[model samples]
Target: MNFFPNFANINECLEWVKRKDLALAKMELICQLLNHPEKKQKTIHIAGTNGKGSTVAFLTSIFQNSGLQVGTFTSPHLDDWNERIKVNGISITNHEFFLISQQIMSELEGKVQPTIFEFLTAVALYYFAEIKPVDLVIYEVGVGGKYDATNVISPLVCGITNIDYDHLNYLGNTLTDIAQKKAGIIKKDIPCFTTETKPQILSLLQKISQEKQSKLCKISPAKKFIFDSSQLITNFCLTAKKHTFNLKTKMLGQHQIKNASLAVNMVLYLQKYFPQITQSSIEKGIKEAFWPSRMELISQEPLIFLDGAHNLGGIKSLIQTLKTFFPAKKPIFLISIMKDKQVDKILNTLKKIACQIIFTEIPETRRQEISKLKHNNTAKFHKITDYSKAFFSFYSLLDNQKIGIICGSLHFTALIKREFLMNLNEKLNNFSLSNHQPV
Candidate 1:
């Protein structure tokens, strides 16, 4: 604990160790030492392979719009560590983060050495319980649900947002194995919800819920749905418990319809417990909820977009969104991927619609090597180790007829986004200066 005395040293802590059996037990011990602050707040738990972040966003917005102070915990932030914890869509300030870290360090008295995620989980729970108490807290499972550090608290309701084939090394290979691991969040008599429609997965979730004597609610998009990119919004209708909801979301892609619907259903179910949530609040929340790097449009002139479609499921969704929005155009893809992902499958999938692919490397150690990212068609592929140069090369080739997409890894896209915004700001500043001088 002395080693983690400050906010800066928090990142230096160990991320994970090989011992999976002891992870939950260790977390339980640490919570016990801190008097179990995780139990103080009303909670909702969500776990899945792809849509967890988006679902969390939708739920956070919904509760916030209802005038409830809501605390949210999510992972793998794009730019800042503070992005992992928020209340009312605002991240915890650095000073607050440091204060909580210090309190936890002093309470533990160097008896327990927790991983970075473990320590952060403790900090978030404490913040919501004591530092800035809220009406409710939402916890997004960092990985597979069963042993995830956040699983220590029993939630008012839990959800699984369409499990798929990502995190194979930790969750297992087959769909059944992955579903079981995600189902680990289900608690005794705590109802669960899911948007997964696959029959086999649904049956497994049903069985697990029944064993725990908890009702399993399945959510799906309405057959009548509309997508109008003219205003970059989707209009969909959902019916839960015979009450119909006309919903609209700015988040693109058909998959988002399912994610938003799941959030709506969860909110509807919670209305019995928290009666203040109105239909108007739900509509406003769905409209305003935004999650970055998920089919985010960075520029309109060059028609550039950034997506975090690093897995097979995510890549399929990204491809669907691209085709639906820009049917006639084949995009120039600026891509980089992690070595642990299903690289061949993702690359093969993107190649189907990509007019050309520019490969680049991010600064992360886990990034896939540029030499290994090659296709059989040499004419369609180009490799540049530097991300900035790679992006400019792709940018130079853009025109009214051609579009650009920066995708593959969230980490890579985040770096390019920062670079793009900085350059854009510089250009605007120079333009302003020249105009003023001439006048």
Candidate 2:
């Protein structure tokens, strides 16, 4: 009878997840919002078990480099909710986000209240439409692609980065079932692209593409030419339309290079259709795009690195990149994970490379209990309940010569970054007062 609260803030939305079942409820709300007169513009829909965020970032940068104003929507913001919505790499300001939330709340006053993700996706679409300069929009599906709210966009091009076991409870238990859900983003008569596919997923893609009469472009990493890898750069190129031009990127990881190639191919598809995207623009965009928490180096003293490799596939890539980038020795790690994730797989992998493990929880209801993490061998483990304390404890144990890795979840990385910045500011202020350096 009453909806007075109407989603006050992101914290409220985070709390709402605890009460609702994650499957199909938000999808229905997205459909309702799509039926409204406010929706506009064709989107580039992306889905996968890994590399979705990085792929979206690459595409957004490419479009922007070609001088088209672009809007991008992504999920599970690493450092800020504002990171979820951006125009040309600038986050939507807090005031802007609040206004959009208020307008959506007002619109749903008498109707069914939309879920947080549904409301946010609607707000992003409405904002991008209302803004005059936006020429292209890239929407990253919040969950599995099939019923993801962003699927309402009817994208011009669809891309699946990689298929792996993830979100099994909500999507499906088997790989084929998961691939089928991801393939849902492939629209009728739209071009679809993929990178490094499995035989099972490729079969699903072939079936869906045939049914929709869509063109499917499958990419194999081994088939492509890769030159080099470093801490700051990843370089590679793919054969598209019979060209092997150089493709250099700032993002880390060989897997990311594959994602970049997929994005590059999408731009090529747009070029064939739109006739405006130049090879130069694609190169510039790929070189400039950045997604936080994927092989991000936040500190140099102790060589602190943060990655959001929450899934097994991503975790494998993260480990490979770690070895390739830092080949000297094993590093200390501060790790946390979601309660629903494959914790044992990750822990087993980590035990092999981590010299010491500091277990902490991200500030979320979905966080797994650190105490519950099963250890393969009785190696060193420190359980710190709070992220800030965990970070501090981990930092104290590290010397200037050691490398520190903080990973497991994107939210954990974001929380640690915020707290680390805050602590640095406080220490600077205290130093200034103690030395009487400023008035």
Model number with the top TM-score: 1
Q: In candidate 1, which residue pairs clash?
A: none
Global lDDT of each candidate: 0.86, 0.77
lDDT of 2 by residue, 92-206 (tens): 8888888867876776676666778878888787678764337778899888887777777777889999889888888888888988888888878998999946787798899
Candidate No. with top lDDT:
1
Clashes of each: 0, 0
lDDT of 1 by residue, 1-439 (tens): 2322243453443332233345587888888888889888999999999999999999999998999999999988889999999999899999999999999999887688989999999999999999989999999999999989999988999999998998889989999999998998998989899999999999999999988899999887776667775787888888887878888888888889889988999999999878999989998999999999888878878788888889999989988887886787778888998988898898888888888888889888889987776554367877778776676667766777877888888888888888664586574454453333210
Error of 2 at 303 (Å): 1.4
| Candidate 2 worst ten-residue window by lDDT | 430-439
Let me know the TM-score candidate 1 reaches against the reference structure: 0.90
User: What is residue 260's positional error in candidate 2, in angstroms?
Assistant: 0.5
Error of 1 at 80 (Å): 1.1
